[model samples]
Target chain A: MPSPSSTKPKVSALGSFIVIVWLMVLAVAAFLATVVPEIDTLLGRSHLDRTVISAAQAAIAITTVVLLILALSIMKEVYIGRKLR
Target chain B: MLQAITVVLYGAIVSAVSFFAVYFLVPVMIKRLVASGHVVQDYHKPDKPKVPRPAGPALMAGIAASEIILYILTLDSSVLAILFTTAIAFVVGLVDDRKVMPGWFKPGALLLAAIPIIVLGAHPDHLNLIFGRVFIPLLYIPLVFIVIPIAGNTINSIDVLNGVASGFLIIATIPLLVSIAIFGNQDTFLAALPLLFTTLAFYKYHKFPSRIFPGDSGTVLLGALFGALAVAGSSEIIGVIVLLPAVMNSFLFLASVKKIIEHRQVKARPVTLLGDFRLAASKDKSAPITLVRLILADGPLGEREIGIQIFKLAVFAAIMALASIGIQYYFLKDVIR
Candidate 1:
């Protein structure tokens, strides 16, 4: 398992990082989805309560981030193998 | 109304992310595949010989990864209707990427991919045709799947150049996004906006003489995303029309491949270069066409020139997108109320 390269693959690594951060964001969102329970309570008491659209959006975002990580991990694996070969 | 909007927007964003993710990862995947010995590296061919070694497998890895992610995300969010459709499209692409299937099998897969949408409440209820007094069925399930996958594969074929395939996709999406805006489909607007942006970013690196190629990953992603969006837009006829540009490009490439193959057989040569654009040449041709020469040439429009031509057609697709919207407004506008 060679470390990811800092050359041509740097951009891909950047994408991987984006996905990683996105994953964190999604985790926080899913947590918030359970913790808040109600849209009004979530928004009135917390900073994230804006619209039902927002929560649904967070769900979509989290899902996308998770997907992004899956894509990037594939990329990372491919990139490292290519670089080494 | 709000919930509907959210759903549409979610679809659009997912489409966008799906497209770019595939585009970005394909090159790396190719490198990996080459390394893993799953695919062999063709180094003997001239043109960009020094750019590491990965090639075909990268395309597969990128495509497979993106599709899996797409399916997972769809299940996670319960966007079931489009999920299975995309999965079918992905498998079709995967098969195409791995090995050539029988000609009929390809079309069969396309039809299969179109099933989920047709069955799970995704069909467009509006029908429009050129001739008067001809009653076309609103639930045109057969045509939808048949044509959509054909369109998808066509776009995939034409996507040989950098920026060309993605460029056409962005162009096609603009009108869809606009239609959503005018008709007040806010959710779709939010989701699809990112597609435009991500594709643009990809274009920056993908344009002619590209640093990287989209390969199968990019092509399959574009195909599925476009198919899903067209269906999700609920403006099927127009979506099909807007995609005509890609249709033309793909046709041209297909013709070229056919001619090249036929010429090779007729000449009894190892390779035959069609016209001046030498993808592969007949064994007898003294000056066989090469990919490098075709890319670098000023005249004798080869794949590069054809790619740009396809882009021009995409600009025209904007009109088709608008027309589709208008037609949708005529039929479905009242339903939403």
Candidate 2:
């Protein structure tokens, strides 16, 4: 016979987890924004072909996407996966 | 000073028009909907009240009228692009509201909403990262197509509780407006006004103990408008960052369900109602995981509290979004320069 107000709201772990995921995603974005351009510059100085530089940039973009997917998977695992187990 | 005064004048007029349009129309739409027997049960409520639904037409009217006025005043094609994109999404949502379409229908159909933006050349060729911009002329076209559907569906998916969708939109749009004001032009910022004010108006009826649900039509329209504004304003990165909570909600549901299926098709719900009308996270492993469920993970809570929790997450995401902009402006100034 517990009334609705009888239960106090507890701080959610999921909230913290979401913030962690956001930071990870932001880190990845920062890496792309800063590090990738520097890598392009270094590659250009090495006299890499235009297509080679483009390919290298594309690889980083793909890696960024993959890293994001990994981050999401980790979130899923930590919250849903652990609960199911 | 004259120019600033004119801008303020137009902003005030458009805001008033958008806000009042929905404010007045929703009550009428509610009566009409209920008369036509278009109502849905509010399961979260203990008594299960049947709230009139599909407030889409009224919402569209409010947004369209305000945008058209702004367009006539400013002659901005970007305004037309947003208007058309939102209209198309409204139609698609209205269709789904009338018929039980496949889960893919809304997302797939929403892809068409991107057409207006693309054909009008409303988006920029470069993608704006926080620190700098990347020219993606070829990739930008496909990105436009992908982004509209994702944005439309993200808001739609998050509309599980009363007022969560509209309230989320209100909070989420803050960072977008800030970003647009900072990095984008005035035309796009003016174009985004209706979205903010219309939702503000509709939220009066859509909030806790909702008298009228926005239905699929209303949610999709707001979502599509958000997507359109982001692209047209070239604030795509900020837009995505602010929507992390809704995006995460969509991701969790899809991952748990392992498919693009309608939520109604799922037998096990992520949340269950207690006898006292509080919501508890479902213990059934088969149930799909959702943001609301996660919010209730610690214990059962009233619907209003859960909605507030989601808003808190959105506010946090907005702060992070602002931080991202700060990083670009302050920390990475040299690189961007």
TM-scores of the candidates are: 0.55, 0.94
Q: What local lDDT score does residue B41 receive in model 1, on the 0 to 100 scale?
A: 26
For model 2, the superposed segments whose C-alpha errors exceed 4 Å read A42-52, A82-85, B331-337
Please give the distance, in angstroms, between residue B308's alpha carbon in candidate 1 and its true position after superposition.
2.8
Task: For model 2, report the TM-score of its A chain.
Answer: 0.75
- Per-residue lDDT for B100-214 in model 2, tens only? 9998999999999999999988888877777677777766899899899999999999999999999999999988987777666677888888899999999999999899999
Q: TM-score for candidate 2, please give it.
A: 0.94
Q: What is the DockQ of each candidate?
A: 0.01, 0.45
TM-score of chain A of 1: 0.37
Q: What lDDT tens digits, residue by residue, belong to model 1 across residues A1-85?
A: 1122222211233234333433443344344333433444546665554555355544653466466446644653454334322
Q: Give the DockQ of candidate 2.
A: 0.45
The pairs that clash in candidate 2 are: none
Distance (Å) between predicted and true CA of A35, model 1? 58
